[model samples]
Target chain A: MTLAPFEGADALVRRNNISSQGPEGAPAIVFGHGYGSSRQMWRLVAPQFVDDHRVVLFDHVGSGGSDRRAYDRGKYDSLHGYADDLLEICHALGLSEIVYVGHSVGAMIGCLAAIAEPTLFDSLVLVGGSARYINDEGYVGGFEADDVDALLDSLDANYLAWASTMAPVFMGNSDRPELTAELLDSFSKADQAVARQFARVTFLSDLRSDLSSVSTPTLVVQSTNDIVAPVVAGEFLRDSIPGSRLEVLEAEGHYVHVSDPEKLTTTIRSFLG
Target chain B: MNPGVQARDLFDLIPCGLISATTRGVITTVNDTFLAMVEKKREEVVGHHLIEHLTPGSRLYFETGFMPQLKAHGRASEVAFDLCLSSGETLSVFLNAVVDRERDGGTILFAVFDATLRRHYERELLAARRLAERSETRVTILQTATTAFGNAGSEEEVAHALADASRAATDAMAASVYLCDPSGGFSAPSSSGAAKQLVEAALLDALGGRGDPSPTGGLAQSPTTVVYSGSAELSAHFPSAAAALRTARVEALATVPLIDDGALGGILLASFGRPRRLDPPTVDLLESLAQQSVLVLQRIRLRELISYRSLHDPLTGLPNRHSLQRRLDQLLTGTHPNQPTIAVLFIDLDGFKSVNDRFGHLAGDSVLRRIGASLERAVRSGDMVGRLGGDEFLLICEDADEQSAGDLAERLRATVRNTPLEEATGLSVSASVGVSIYRPGTSPEKPTGDALIQLADEAMYQSKRTGKDRATIIRA
Candidate 1:
C-alpha cells in the first residue's frame, strides 16, 4: 500500500505521544536523521525496510515532525536530550531487540542512547560517525578549529547556498541537480538559529570517551571517497569502539545510503543477519 | 615564417612559445627571444639537430614522449614536462604541439611557455602562510595567558588560572599548581591529573617521612626564597617535568610565591608535560603574577581577621553579644522553618552587693568569672550561653518545647543553689533563673533577640520576688 505524505510530526503527535508505522509482528527498526534533515531523510530507505521490519521514524523535538512547543533549549542543546527522547519513545512503544540506524548527528544520539539504556536496542548502525571532530593531544582528525569555524560562518552567511553547494558533494551526484534543491529546502525549513545551534553541537561535540561506554553490537559504514566525513574519521570510530565492525563501501561520498542504496542495503542486511 | 617581425612583438606577441622542428630534429625557425634563451645565433647553425643543442636529460625526454606523442596524435595541448637548457638549469614548461592539417602532418610546431617564476612565487606564498599561522598561534597563547593572570583574584583562583593557562599555552596532557601551607611545606592545593595521589605524596613528604622532597622550600619563611627549584625531586614525582626533559618537548613550569608582608605565605607551583624553556619574558610574567598573588593573599587574610573579630569576644575569646544573640535567635525561633519549638533561660546573680562592700568588688568579679565557667560546662555544644551584661547571663536551648524547658530550668536552679559560692568569695551568691517558652504565631512580629531576652528577664524578676535561687516559667 502506498503511504500518504506525512503531516509534520511536530503537529501530528502531542509532545507526549509516540507514533509508529508498519506491522506489529515485523522486525523493529528505528530511523534517525541528522541535524538539518528530518525523518523525511528516510523516505527512500524506510519503504524498502518496512516490508520486513516495523520502520519507526520520528523528528527530534525542535525539528521536522516533533512538538516544537516542547522544545526546551537546555534539554535539546546536547546529545543527551535526544537520547532521552529516544528512550521515552522506546518505553512508550514497549519496543525491545530493536535495530537503530542513524546518520551523522543521529548516529551520535543513537550511540548515546544505547550507552544510557543498553537493553533498549540490540544493534546499532552508525553512518559517517566520528568520536571527536576536533583534533586533540592523541588523535588527529583533519580540519583545525578555524576550519570548522569557517564552515559555520559559511553556513550562517547563506544557509541555502551552503546547502546547495554541500548537497552535491554530500550525495556525490553532480549529474543530478535536483538533489541540491531538496537539501536546500530541508535546511531552510528549520529555524536558522536552532539549526546553527544544532550544527555546533553536532560538529563540535567530542564523544571519544562516549564510544568506549557503548555495549551494543555496532556497525560502522564508511564511504570510500567521502570528503565531508572522511575515511580517517570512520577508521577512528572503528578503532575506538570495541567489537565494532567496519564496512568500507566503494560508494562515492557521504550520502552513500542515498546514492548507492543497493550496496548499502546489502551490507546492512548481511551485518544484521 | 615571418622574418621581418620585430623581436619584442614576436617574442611577446602570444602567451605561448613559438618554435620550428625539422624531420631530423633540427630547429629551423627560432625567435630572437628563444635564440637568446638557448644562447644561440641564427648563422651559427640552422642545420644542427635540436637534441644536440639541448641538455642530455631534455634530449632523452623529447625523444621518448614529446616527439612520439606529437607525431601520433597530430597535436598535444598543455603537456607539462621539464626542459633542461645548456646552462645546466631545469625549467618547468607547458608544451603545446601545433600541426597544420594542410601540411601533410610531417612538420610539428612546438610552443613552450616558462612556468618557473610562477611556481617559485606559489611556493613562497605557501611558506609565508605557514609562518603567519604560527605567529597567530603564538599571539593567541600570549593573550590567553595574560587574561588568565589578570582574572586570578585569590590563591585558589591563581592556582586554577595558572593550571588552565599552562594547559592552553603548551597544549599538554595535563597541568597542575601545588601550593605550600603555613609550615614552610608545599602540597598540591589545586591541580589536574591524578592530583589527589600527587597531593597526598607531597603532603606526606613535606610532613617529614621522605618521598618527593619539596619542590619549593617553605615560602611561609620567606617568599623570595620560594623560587622555581628545577630539583631532581620535582622531576621524579611530577610526570610533566620528566616528559618535558625527556622528549625535549615544550612544557611550561612556573613557581610564584604566595607572599604577605615580605614573609612567604606559600608557593604556587604550575607545571605542564612539555619541554618549555623559562624564557626571560615568561619569567617576567611569572614574577608579576607572584606579586599580584601576594596582594591577593594579604586581602584574603585581612578579610578573615575581620570576620573572626566580628564573631568572637576580644577579652575572653568567647562569642561576643552580637554573635551570641544571633545564635540565640536562630535557636528560639527555629531558623529551619520546619522545626517546632525552642526555650530560653535568663539568670541574674543574687547577693553580689554585700561581697562588693565586705571583701571588695574584685572578689565579686572573681565569683562572676567562676559562675561563667560553671555555666559553660553545664550547657551542651549546640546550646548558646552568653553574658547579656554585668551579673546577668542568657541560655538558648534548641528543639525544646514547653515541657522540656521546665525540666531543664528546674535542674539549672538546683545546680546553682547547691554551688558553694560563699567559700570562694566569703559571701553567699545565688542565681534567679527564668524560663520563657516560645509560642509560634502569637506575635505577628517574629521574636527578636531583644524580645526573647525581655521575656526571660521578667520571669527572672518574678523568681527573685518569691525567693532567690529558684526558677519561674513564663509562657508567651
Candidate 2:
C-alpha cells in the first residue's frame, strides 16, 4: 500500500521521505480519502495499480500521518486551498499529466483544481463526488440546509456522541465494535472549529456549472445504494459533463471501497486502461 | 412484596396530592397533605363533586376552561387554580390532571401542590425594583434643570440668571457683579442692596478708594483671590464687612465671570449663609453661562458682514461655488426618472503656467482673476460658473445632452482664446475643457467621486490631442 498525505503548502511542510513502490516514470496517481477516513482507504486498492503506475496515497491535512500543525481555518476556508496543496505536491514531485482519485470532499477538491488549472491533471476519477452535498433548486443532492445545520450543531453539542455515532460508519464495521475507538481517536485529532469549517465548505459549495467546463477526461464511480452519495447524483454528473462517464457498483453501504475492494479496483483499472 | 402493605406505605409517603375525579367532577380520593392543606376530611370530600371543593370564583374558571382543556388533551400539567377548604378559606395550588381511558372510559387523576409563598415573594421583589427606578428618574430630571442656565442666549442674561439661580439654590441674602478693566481695575458694575452698601463702606472708607487696586483683576485670576493676596490684607482694608461676611457660616460663595469683546466684562458674586458644597459640574455650568453672554454681544457685529458677502463669492466677487455645486450635485443625483441629462465641463488653461512662470506672480494673479470675469459672461443665466482651483474652472449646463455639451465646450474654448501676456507680451493663450454626460447604467462600474472627474479629464486630454484651443465631449 502506498501512502500520500495532502498537507497545505502554506503550512509547515514535513520532510517525510516515505518510499514509493511503483513504476519510476509512470504518471503519478494520487489518492485522497473521504471524510472520517485516512490514507489507509486505498490500502486494498493500491496494490493492483502499483505495478502499472506510480501510486501515491496520503491523509488530508489534519488526518492520519500528516503534519497536524499545518491545519489553519483562515487559510483553508475553501477547497481551492486544498487544491492548491494538491498542485504543490504535483509540482514538488515534478509529476505532470497525473490522474487524481478522490472520495467525497477529496473528489470535489480534485474537480476544483482541474477547473482552476486544466492542464495540471490528465484525468480525474471522482468516487462519490458531489458538487454540492446539500440540495437546492434544480438539484437533488441528499442533505438539506437544515439537515447539514443540524449535523454541525450536533457535532458541537456533544463531541462524544458525534464520535460514537459517526466513527463506526466511517470504520465500516458492524460485526467488530472495537474499531470504533480507533476511528474516534482519528476524528478527535483536529480542532473542532477547523473541522466544522471544513465540513461547511465541503458540504455547501455549488459546483454544478463547474462540471460543464471540465476539459479533462473524467470518470465518476458511485455506489448504487451508498447512503453518502446517491446513484441519481452520479447520473447528474455524467449527463452534465460533456464527455464524463459514470459507473455504479452494487455495494451495501457508503464505504464500498472497504467492503468490496476487489470489484472497485477491477472497475477502476478497466476504465483507466 | 406484600401489595397491601406497599400500597399503604406509598400512599402516606407521597409528596403530592393524589385525588381521583369522576366524569361529572366528583372527588373520590384525597391524600393526607392535601387534606391538611385544604383543612378538609376525606369522608366529607370523597363523595362530593370537585366543584364543591373549589372557591366560588375559581369554580367558575375551572368548569369554564380548565376541565375542557384536560378532557381534550388527556393531561394538563402545572395548571394554576384555587381550591376552597371546609372552613371557606382559599388556597393557591398547581394541579396536574391525568385522564384514564380504560375502566370508566374517563377517570381523572389530580396532583396538587401549594404555590402561594413563592408567588408572594416574587411580586414583592418586582414592586421594590419599580420604586427604585422611579426615584432614579426624578434625580435625572433635577440634574438636567441645574445645567439649563449655561446655554442662555446672552452674556448679560447669563450673568443675571446665574446670580438669581445661585442665590435661590443656596438661599443667599444678596448678590453683586464686578468686571475687570484692562488697566488693572476692578469696578462694581451691578449689585443688589446689601452687597452694594458693604463694598462701598468697607473698601472705600478704609483706603480712601486706593488700596493697591486688586492685582488679580485679569480673566486668569483664581476664584479665591485670598491665596494670592492675603485674606488678612483684605481684612485690613475692609475690617467690618470682611469680618461679617467671613463669619456668616455660609455654605458656598461662587463668582462667575462675564467676558465680552476680548475682555473681562463683569463677574457675578453670590454668597450664602447656610453650609453647602456646590457640585463641580454646576460650577462649570455657571462659567459657560458667562461665555454665552459674550457670544451674543459679538454676534451683532458679525451679522452685517455676513449679509454683505451672502450672494457674492469672497474669493472672486462672482457668484459663490456653493450655490453652483448645490445645483450641479442635484442634477447628478437626480430624483425623477425622465429628468433631462446634465453635463459638467471642467475647464483648465493650457499656457497660464508659462505666463505665471515668465512674469512675476503679481501679473499672473491679475490675469487669472480677469479670466474669472470673462468666463462669468460667456455662460447663459441658467448655466452655473465655478472656479475649481488656481487656473481651473467648471461650467455646469442644465438639460444639455452630448451635442449641447459639445456646443457649450466650443463657446468656452473660443471665449478664452486670446493669450493673457500676449496682449502684454504678444504670446498665444488657450484653455482646455472636458465634458462628460451623466447617464444611467452606462458605466457598469460603480460610480465614484474620482471616476467622474477622471472621465472628464480624459476628454480634456483628447482636446489637448487635437493640439490646443479646442473642446471635446465624451459621451457615456
Candidate 3:
C-alpha cells in the first residue's frame, strides 16, 4: 500500500543506487550522469580520483540500477525536484565540502543544489553543460522550442526500438556475461514516461536567473564540439555564474568522459588542486 | 562478370545502406547504396563523421545514447535516426551497427535501413496512444465532476467543482466560472489558478455585452462556445480582453456557455499559456462539463423555487397562513428585552362583500390584492403580513403595546379606505381591524398562534357589530 517504499534521508543511498570506494574519510567526490545514461559513464574518469578521494557514484532514479519503483512523476517534475533528491543523497552520506562532478542535465542539477545549499559543495564541475537549452530572444542555446518537441518524438522512436531490439543485441554478448547483464539492466530500467518527462524538464527549463546566485566555486567544462550543450552554452554558464571559470577541452562529442576521459579527469584534478 | 566483381557489386548494390567506420564514428568507407540513400556522393560521405550526417536531435541521441551502448556491448541494433538529407529535409533511418574490436582502436560496421514507412507507422501509433490517454483522462475528470456536482449542497460548491473539472479536462492554466448577475453582467463566482484577471478579461471580451445578460440571445445565440487558438485570434475577437491576456502572456482560450432552460445562466472559461486548439473530443468534453454545471444550477434554482412556493401565497406572493403561523410561533417562543410584547392584527374587509356582489368576483380579487398591499405598507418593517384565506388578513408585529397596536389598526383601516380600488371597480371598500396583545409573565397561559388568532377574531367581530370600518383592541 505504501507507494514510496523508502522513506527518510537514510534510505536515499540504497534508493539512488549509490556506491562508494577509495579511502574512507577522505575528501569525497560524487559523480552524477547525464540524461539517458547511468553512473557507469564515469568508470574511466572516476577511478583516477579514487586514488586520492572517497569517490561516490549513484544513478538518478529511473536510470541504471536505482530502485525503479522510487521514480515519482510529481517528485521529479522539475530540475529543482531532482536537486532536492541530490541534496538528500549528499546529506544522507554526510558529505560536506564535496567536489561534485555532473554531466549534461546532471550539471544543472548540481548547480541548483549548490545554489540552494552552497556550503554543502566546495565547488562544482559542470561538464558539457548549458544553463538553458531552448533559445530565447537574445540568447542562443542552439535549439528552438520545436526542436525540443522533435527531440521528445525522437526519444519515443528510439525508446520503442530500444526496448525490443536491445535484448537480442545484448544476448549476442554472452562472452561477457557481467557486462551483458549490466547493459540489459541499464536499458531495461528506463520507462518511456519517465524518459519523456525527464527530456521535457531537461530541455525546456531555463536556469539563467539561477546562475548568479551560485556562490560555489565552479568550473565549466566544454568540449570543442558538443551537439547537445554547445560551446556557447558553457561560455554562457561561465559568464553568468559568479566567479566561475570555463575550461574548453580539445575533446569531441557530448560525453567528454567517454570520448576523452584522460583530458576530463586531468581537468577536474587540476581544478580541484 | 567475375566472381570477385560480382561480390563487390553485391556489397555496393545491397538493399540497405552499408558503412564501415572507426569506433569513434568517423566514416572510413560507404557502399553505393549508403551514398544513394543519403543523396550524397561517395567522396562527400567517405570521411565525414556519422553524427554530422544526422539531424540535431538524432545526433544528440546518437552521441549520448547510441554510442554508449555501442561501446559497452560492441554492437547496437535498431537505433532510430533522422538523417539530414541534401535537400534540407530529414529521411528517417533505422541503423544496426557492430564493432570489430580486433582492428586497431576498433572498427564499426553499420547497416542502415530507410524507414520512412516505418516512421510514418510509428507516428500514427504514437498519435493513437496519445488520443487514448487523453480520452481516458477526460473520462476520469468527467466522472469526478459528476460525483462532485451531484453531492454539492449549494451553488458555490457546484461552481468550484466546475472550475476544477474544466481546468483538468483541458489542462489549461486557469479556469473560471462566471454567473449571470442581477445587474445583467457576468460576475466571477468561482476561479481556479493564478491568472484570474486574464481569464476575467477574456470572458468579458469573448462574451460581448458583458453586462447584458439578455436571456436566450446575445452572445449565447452567436455561438454556444468560443475558442481562440492564440493571442492573435483573441485580439481579433476581443481587443481589450486580449490586451489584458497578452500582458499576462496567456495564449489560448476556450469558453463554453452554461445554458439552463434555453437561457444562458453562466459561462465556463479556460485559458492556456500555450497556443492551443481544442480537438473535437476535447471540445465535446468541455461542452459536457458546461452541461453538467447547467444541470446542477438548474437543480439549485428549482429547489429554491419549490421552497419559496411552499411558504408563499399564490396571488399576493406574501407569506400565507402557514407562514404566518410559523412566524407567530417564533415570535411568541423567544423572550427578549428589546421586544417583550407581541401584537397580532386580525383584519376583515367590511365592504368587500358589496364590492364583489356589485363588481363581480374579478374586481373582488383585484380589491383584495390592493388591500393586501395597503396592509403591508401600514405595518412596521418587522411585521409579518399574510392572508388567512377569503377576506381575512393577519399582521404579526413584535415590540408593539396596546397603544401602538390600536394605532397600527387605525392606520390599516384608513389605508384600505384610501386605496384606489374604487376608481377601477366603481366601488369603495374599507377594513374592520381587530388587535390582540400578549406580554410574557402577564398572561397566565403561554401564548400560541391559534389562541392569539381566536382572541383577535373575537375582537374583529366586536368591531363589525359596533360599526363597519372600525378598530377594536383586546389584551390577553
Candidate 4:
C-alpha cells in the first residue's frame, strides 16, 4: 500500500525525492527504506498493492536521487531529524491513519515518527529492525564497540573497496552472484559522505524507549536464520511493542520479502485482515 | 536457460568479473575475466570465503545491509563495493546476484562492472561545490563590514564598529580595537564576542604602560598583518595577550596594526581557537578596515578641536563672551515649569589702569589670568565663570535663594580683596563686584541675559562710587 509522498516547501521536496503511485481513494501505505539503500528496495512489494492501496516511496535526503547539495551536517546529526522528515511527509500529504512499512534503520525511524505524531499512522511493520546495535548487558547486538570502530576505520581507509567487501556479507546467498551484483550497484551510486553519515546515525542510535510508546497495531517480521536481526531481537521488539504480533518467516537471512515474498505478503494480509 | 542468455555468461567474452558462492559465502565459481581482473588464477579466487577477500568496512556493510537483503530475498541485485587490484590501485565495481539452491546451499551468481571513472567524476563535482560555498561566505562578510565603516562617527565609535566588523569578517573568538591618544596614552573600549574573559585581559594590555609613545613598540612593529598560530607561538610573541586568550581556551591570534603616516594609530586584535591562515583577500579586507578607521578617527579629532576653538578663548582657554551669553540665556529661559531664581556677579577691577600704564601690558595680562583662576576657586561647583573680554568677568549661579545670593556676594568681595596681584613689585589690587539676582516672581522687567549684565555693570559703578573692594546688589 502506498500514497504519493508529500511535496511542500521546495527545499524539503527537492532534498527528498518523494514520489508515489496507486489509487488515490485507497488507504495509504508509506514505505521507508533502510540505510545504504533507497526506495528502490521496495520495487517488488510496493507494486503488488498499487491497484488497491495507495503506495508511497521516497529516498531519504542523503540517499538515492535526492539533491546532494541540500545535505546539511547539522540537521542530519541524529535519528530524530530522519523521523521529523517522515512526519512532515505525512503531514504534507494530508494523510491520516497511514500504514508504515519500515526495514532496518527505517523501522526505528517509523516507530519514533509514530510516537511523535500518533494520529499519522494506524499500524507499523518492522522488518529486520533493531533498536541498538552494540552488545550490552542482557542484550545481544552481535557486534562489540571495538568492532564498530574497526569498521569505521576500514571505511575511512578504502571506502570503495569497503562497499565490495560488504556485499557478500549482506547478500549471504552468494551462490547466486546476480543478487549481490544488483545490491552493490545500488550502493555504488550513493554519495560516500552521505553513506558514512547514514551509517553513523543508524548504528549509534538507541531507541529502545521509543518502542514502548508505539501503541499502533504493530507487526514484527522475524526471519528464521536472519543474521542482522536475530530471533531474540525480534522477540524483544514484539515484547516491547505493546499488543504487537510476531510472525516468523522461513527465510535464510534478514531480508524476508526478497527471499520468500509469498510468505511475507500472506502473513501481513492475515494480520491486517 | 536459453542459449543466447547462457552465452551471455561466457567467461572470456563477458568483459567483467564473475563469481559464485554458497549461502555461507564460500566461493564456488570464478570466471577467467574475474581471474584477470584480480590478476589471479582460478585457483586463487575459487574456494575462498567471501569474508577473506573483503575489507573491514565492506565486511561490516555486508553484515549490516547486504547480507540481510540477500538472505530474505533469495536474490539481490546491483550492489556496489570496492576491490583492491594486485597493482595496488583501488577499483570500484557493481555486482548482481541470484540464489540457486540446486547444486549448492543456495548458490549465488555474480556479475561485476568497473565503475572507477564514474566515482572520480562525482568526487570532482562535490569538491567544486564546497569551494564555491566558502567563497560566497567571504563576500557576504566583506559587504557587511564596508557598510558599518561608512556610518561610524568618532574614534571610539570607529573602534567599536571595527571590533564588530573584525569578528564578523573572521570566525574569531574575540576582537578588540586599541587606539593611541595624542598624549601617548593607549586605551581600548570594552569589546565583546565569543570570548569575553580573554578580551578583558587583551584590553588590559592597552591600558598598561605600553600606551607610552615609543616608535619601536609592539603595535608599532606590526604595521602589516601579523598572525600567531597555536599556543606556543602566540605566547612567545604576545606573552600577556596570549596568556589571557589561552586561559579562555583560545589557541590563535591575528593582529592588524593601524598606522596613520608615521604614528601608530591603533592595533586590531582577534583571537581564535584554531590555527588561522589569513588568505590574501581576507588580509586585504582587514587592512582596508584599519585604513578606513584611521581616516574617520583623524577627521573626528580635527572636527572636535575646531569645535572646541569656536567657544573658547585661545590664550586662557576660558569660555569666551559668546559662550557665556549662550549659557546665561539657557539658564534664564530654559526652565519652564519652575521659576527658580538665579544670580550673576559681574566684576570690574579697580585701580587696574595705573598698573598697566606703569608695569606694562604683559604684567597686566598676567594679573588678569591669576585673578581669573582665584575667582574660579572661590565660587560654588555649579557656577559658570567666563572671561567676557578684558578685565570684565561674569559668574552665573543657578537655583539660588536671596539669602544664599547675599552670602555668595560677600564671599566674592572678600576673595577679591584678598588677592595680592603678583610680580608688579608690591602692587596689591582689589575688585568691585556687582551682584544682580533674577527672581522671576519679584522681577520688575522680563529677565534677559543682556539686561542682567547691564544692571550688574551699573551696580558695579555704584560700588566704585562708594569706594572699591565691596559688592553691591542690583535688584532686577
Docking class of 1: incorrect
Per-residue alpha-carbon lDDT of model 1 for B239-315, expressed as tens digits? Answer: 44353332321123444555556555555444432222355645555555556555655665577789878886554
Q: TM-score of the B chain in model 2?
A: 0.35
Best by DockQ: 3
* Candidate 1 per-residue lDDT over residues A210-233, each given as its tens digit: 688789999999887554466888
TM-score of each: 0.47, 0.36, 0.61, 0.51
Which ten-residue region of model 1 chain A has the weakest summed lDDT?
A1-10
Q: List the residue pairs that clash in candidate 1.
A: A9-A65, A10-A65, A10-A66, B184-B218, B249-B275, B250-B274, B250-B275, B251-B274, B251-B275, B251-B276
Positional deviation of residue A108's Cα in model 2 after best superposition, in angstroms: 1.7
TM-score of chain A by itself in each prediction: 0.81, 0.82, 0.88, 0.84
User: What's the DockQ for every one of the candidates?
Assistant: 0.03, 0.00, 0.18, 0.06
**Model 3 segments beyond 4 Å from truth?**
A1-7, A10-15, A18-28, A50-56, A65-77, A91-95, A165-190, B1-7, B69-74, B121-133, B144-476
Q: Which stretches of candidate 1 lie over 4 Å from their true place?
A: A1-18, A68-77, A135-140, A159-190, B1-346, B353-389, B392-409, B417-428, B433-467, B471-476
TM-score of chain B of each: 0.53, 0.35, 0.74, 0.70
Docking class of 3: incorrect
Name the docking class for model 4: incorrect
